[model samples]
Target: MESYGDLLNNNKVIFDDRNYGFWKSRMKSIIGGIDRLAWKTVLEKWEEPTIKDEKAIHCSVGRKQFELIQGCETAKEAWDILQIQYEGTSKVQSSRKDMLASRFENLRMEEHESISDFSSKISTLAQEAVTLGENI
Candidate 1:
């Protein structure tokens, strides 16, 4: 009986790196054991259009890279998947930074005005009230 790794080894050329060979063979084994529907599900999950966390982008990108190294049908498709994931993650990070900056600016403006402006207004109001009461 031939293992899935043997079949993949027969089909593709092995690289010089032992660790790379092990993972490529492992991925091939997993991919080969499954039916087409299961394979499609796995690939779809790896290339899913949505992301919940920044770290998910790394997984998606890594999957694409592994697929490319394992000789996918289309390199461009793998690249496009990686690009989309990276873009989405970057956008989220950028939006978070913008939100933080806006909050900081608001806090700075409030701090600059609240203490000095309130004290000056209170002092002026007290002086005017005292003057009016004295005249009366």
Candidate 2:
């Protein structure tokens, strides 16, 4: 839910080219929970950098990704298009899974770190995995 969380904090979502899961989950929570009439307004709030009304998406997306959503009438449509474009195929998903698994395997709590810091580190990684479709 990082994207939605960023939006809630009045910050633009920071997306790397690869982090589709994090963005998609947050989008689902927002879009799925709301009624159809509320879709455009909510999409406007998160994607537009300005508070003024306009028929556009002005968020922090890449140029190609931005092009895919041009003239989209609803945030839901834009989100769907983005999912199709960036979610990748099964092989890509497998590769990402393997990479994350290796990182988690090498993780260790540093001796000098406070208990809170250690817990937060663990929690953040765990949250990331969960967002990426890990059962844990």
Candidate 3:
């Protein structure tokens, strides 16, 4: 998620006046923590539903996650909080990818789950691998 976010950010795909809605909505759709950002914009001040939804997302997180993301004003802030907390910096993310590569290579289908489920699991891992700069 962090890698993908960085990829998009590096491409200048978000953060523009024209792209604010597009980037945020894209983030909400594609990124995990970013999804906590509200989709609907209300005319009313602060938008009750938005605040409620953000609070719910925050409250559901663990203490560590909460501490990292505490006092976020928007979903983008929360998303950035988690990314920093988990990945620290881009250099750290590279190291993390190196560490995970071997394990990812060893990924296999478990017998207990159905093939579809197992495929889903591997496909998710594969996507993560791709995110981490691996070819497989």
lDDT of each: 0.40, 0.58, 0.53
Which lDDT value does model 2 have at 98? 80
Q: lDDT per residue, candidate 3, 1-136, as tens digits?
A: 4563453444333233232334433444544333343333211134344324454335435565667667876555676665555545888878877767766778787768899997887776666655445656
lDDT of 1 by residue, 1-136 (tens): 5554444445443322223323333443445453445345434544443632222112223443555434433323443444344323656646645554454344433455778786665554443333222110
Compared with the true structure, what per-residue lDDT tens digits does model 2 show for residues 1-136? 3444344445334344676666555554444444454455554554543544322233645566677777775565666567556655667666767877887888788989988998887776776677657744
Q: lDDT value for candidate 2?
A: 0.58
By TM-score rank, best first, the candidates go 2, 3, 1
* Pairs of residues at least 3 apart in sequence or in different chains that clash in candidate 2: none
Candidate 3 C-alpha error for residue 69, in Å: 1.8
Better of 1 and 2 by TM-score: 2
- Give the range where candidate 1 is weakest over 10 consecutive residues by summed lDDT: 52-61
Q: Give me the runs in candidate 2 sitting further than 4 Å from their true place.
A: 1-22, 36-64, 71-77, 84-87
